[model samples]
Target: MLSNQIRKYTTGIILIVIVVLISVLLFFRKTQLNPVTGKKQHINLTHQQEIELGLECAPDMAARFGGLYSNTDIKNKVKVIGQKLVAVRQVSKSPYQFDFHILADSQMVNTFSFPGGQIFITRGLLKLLKTDDEIAIILSHEIGHVMGRHTTEKLSGFDILEKFKDSTHVITNYSPNQINSYITDLLKITFDSEEESEADELALKYMVEAGYNPKAFPEILEKLSGKSEIPGAEDFLNRHPVPENRIENLKSTIIKYHKRK
Candidate 1:
């Protein structure tokens, strides 16, 4: 009986040591610099891995939003603007392959991007946009998320390998409820307000490079702030810096980047 007890304690000690070792390895492995932001970031996934993950998850994500929008004109417009954003030398140099999608859900006023480069904006958010420049602003902001590799940076802090053992199961096996909950949690994840601010700055730069007015970025944020009392808009608002704060920062960015000498 004593021998069995001793063996059980030894096994427990071995498991604890293994867990600690894995944690240490993950910490050390994650200290690479972000290509776009030029900041040291902890991201476990490679650009290729992030792209594959986004591609695998894209179909399921669209399904959750009641599938893709049926309007070819709107769809084509988003694709064109997204491509223009990528055409900017700064964005074009990145490793991600950006793709834009318009979600059919008209009640959710939000825009989001998966790691790598799959960006989606709901029709509800599209309805709020008053010009092509507004669309450019939104898509470029998402492009910033992709370029910043924010999603994988979030995943790096967790036991990503354990959570996505097969990786393929991230899209294939999870139930709709499970996927929704997982994505909701991910969307809630943030990298301080600095990251959002940086994305805004990037959006401004990209919009200007694409020949859209940087002022439109701030205009859309103001519009969203006015409509914040709407139910589903919380996803966009809560996850971002307050619109007033963003507008203030954006003014500084516009002066620094967009002002004529």
Candidate 2:
């Protein structure tokens, strides 16, 4: 009886290991070519699906920030700058359609983009921007996020993470907290900083192509770095890259861009 029990336990472990290996392999196997970046990436959603998801979530996102900004001229200006960036060949040929919006929130200095191309800048962040080109810097960076397909890649990551978590839980019978800790330690992913750097690099290229001043890159980073809301060292693991590192990376990328020109 003891021998049979041991055999059953060994077989269960083998099955779980096979399931985990297959899951990881399947996750890595899912790939699509990113049009703008010209690199292959793992993504679970089609361009149309990403666009639909963005459009569906945008209204709620704006509402959370007290809806869109009310100034017509400001709205038009932001839209035009975004259009100029999108018109750059690298961006123009991409599958995403870009739309820019200004949020009414004047206290939060933030800019972000959704999966497809729904980009937003809070009024507080806009107020700090001193020029149209500065605006372009922010918009282009968000454009980079969209073009990079970071959101869908994240979605894919989560999907695989859930599967792995389920498989492990079945094998170990770990408590919820233990499983959470196990997963966190198993994959302490730090892709955000890399993605931020990529976006900054893309922004530099797009700005130069679109005829925006690359000088504004550092200027805006400097201004943003001074903001109280910018992530500090303690927030490193939880938030986006610290502004100081981003400024340094931006400077190096700008130098590279100038050399290319």
Candidate 3:
């Protein structure tokens, strides 16, 4: 019995070492330079693959938000502004094709982006914006998320992949719906505080480059602060940095950019 116990312990150690070795191999093999951020990242998916995945998941995401908004004018407005930002910003020179949509949900006040460039804003959030610049700020921020490849980077992390591998029941038995749900859950995972700050900085730069007033960035954040009685404001706050903190960071960013100019 003692010999059997020792053997089991030895086998467990061997399995742990094997897992570590495989993770290390995957890490080195997948490391690639992110074009927009100029930082090396361990991403397992190509730009095309990211775009394809976004496309596959877009329908399901839209359905969750009550399908795409039926208003042509609102849809066109979002598309126009989104395209304008992408056209003028240097970071938008990536391989991902950017598309923007408005969700029909009038009660969920939030915005988000998919891996490759699909951005969506809810009608509920749209009604709160006071200016076109504020709209630009929102879209530019989502653009920053795409440009930074936050979703893919988060998904490709060693820990997440390991968890996914362990949880997956069969290698080839997963359905498209299951894959979509998995990716959707992954996307729902909030960006860390540092990432949120970085995306804000990116958005500020993009807005400035695109000739939008940098002040609008913080102004919108202030509007979205805790004082607001918006229906989904609490949910938004939970997923994002505190408004005061974001505003302070944006102020510093604006000062630095102005000094450079």
Please give the range of 10 consecutive residues that has the lowest summed lDDT in model 1. Answer: 165-174
TM-scores for every candidate against the unseen true structure: 0.81, 0.74, 0.81
| Tens digit per residue, CA lDDT, model 3, 162-209 | 433323231333456666665567646687777788788888888888
Residue 201 error, candidate 2, Å: 0.5
Tens-digit lDDT string for candidate 1 (1-261) = 999999999999999999999988767665678867888886666677777667767887898899999999989999998999999999898888899999999999888898889999999889888789889989998888778777677765554324543233223354555556546656677555778887887888888888988776776777677544655776677666554776888888788885563
Best by lDDT: 1
Clash count for each candidate, listed in order shown: 0, 0, 0
- Per-residue CA lDDT of model 2 for 1-261, tens digit only, reads 999999999999999999999988876666678866778897756676667656766666787789999999999999999999999988898778789999898877777677779898888778877789989988998898888887567765563234432231222233545434433332343347778888888888888999998787776666455554553322222334555777887888788788887
* Cα error, candidate 3, residue 99 (Å): 0.2
Spell out the clash pairs found in candidate 3.
none
How many clashing residue pairs, candidate 1?
A: 0
Evaluation by TM-score, superior candidate among 1 and 3: 3
Q: Cα lDDT of all candidates, in order?
A: 0.78, 0.73, 0.77
Ranking by TM-score: 3, 1, 2
lDDT of 1: 0.78
